[model samples]
Target: MERRGTRAAVRTATGTVRRPERTATDEDWPAACREAVLGGAGLLAALTALDGAAGSLDPLRGGLWAALAVTLFALLLPPRVTAGQGWLSARGPLRRRTVRTDRLVSVRWSEGIAQRLVLRDDTGRRLVLDPRVLLANPALWHLFATGARTAQASGALLCGATALRQLTERAEERTARTLLAGSGRA
Candidate 1:
């Protein structure tokens, strides 16, 4: 069999990139769950103390407690990426959202020392996600462009349309090459 290049080609003719699946490790689940539980307990305790000491606490005591609670909630809610039924969903502690493969607008790597996947929605919102946070084999950058493209096409949240358009144009040449190759093979 012929050896394929390290850089996989994304074209209509070639199959879409299949990201490796991952299962949460025993440690992963428990650690995240424990953090969430601890954070909740801490927030509850702080809020109760603030309420009891309202007269003595700072004027901004309520706001401070609220902020702390929000922060704790976010930390406790683990973010997860799930792939099934022809769609990829990013489930975060605060919210859960999904995008189909066809809705993807574009995916690309952000230019940085610690590279990340910069995904754009149709309305031009950009989400810079770290691969380390996700449970997938492909580098996080690889998923950004594809996921954006898929999300866009599927009418998912249009968060960064402007950024997506700019990035797509910049990578047009490379994308064209892949498309052409795939077309030829097909």
Candidate 2:
């Protein structure tokens, strides 16, 4: 069934009207961007205030400080992720990457300061995104899971069943916790 308010209509080349596939995006992107901007501004303000009180504020120095703040902002900015019926995309400050989830060849988790979910498709396309985003957005998760299942069923997915299972278990646990807490039974 097609979801309401999620699809756009398109006219195909065969003179047919069809609903174009919908894409789910990271819903918390606005808040993340706001946090990035606030952090950059706060750092810039602190540096300026400190320099002004120390009698060291100058245009060249101020320019350099501003540049630093801008750099920090760019560095802190998270990639925007979007997913469709068969594809997922991550757009960063410099470029956008997409992978066909329905033709996936590999999936894995990269451990670091922040955990990242990495996906690769049969066409050699790759994308990496934060798993927290998927946990927070059901629509995005649904689309991604559907595509992953399709790939697995078609024998295209080879290396990521464990990763996907882990995520599914996590999501289930989180849901159970939320339900229990909401019902005052936690």
| Candidate 2 TM-score, true structure as reference | 0.88
Candidate 2 C-alpha error for residue 21, in Å? 2.0
lDDT of each: 0.53, 0.87
lDDT of 2 by residue, 1-186 (tens): 114444668788999999866778888888889899998998899999999999999999899889989898988889988888899888988999999989999999866688999999999898888888887777888888899989999999999999988888887787788889999999
Candidate maximizing lDDT:
2
Off by over 4 Å in 1: 1-30, 43-67, 111-115, 120-128, 135-186
Error of 2 at 43 (Å): 0.8
Specify the highest-TM-score model's number. Answer: 2
Off by over 4 Å in 2: 1-15, 111-113
**Alpha-carbon error at 61 in model 2, in Å?**
0.6
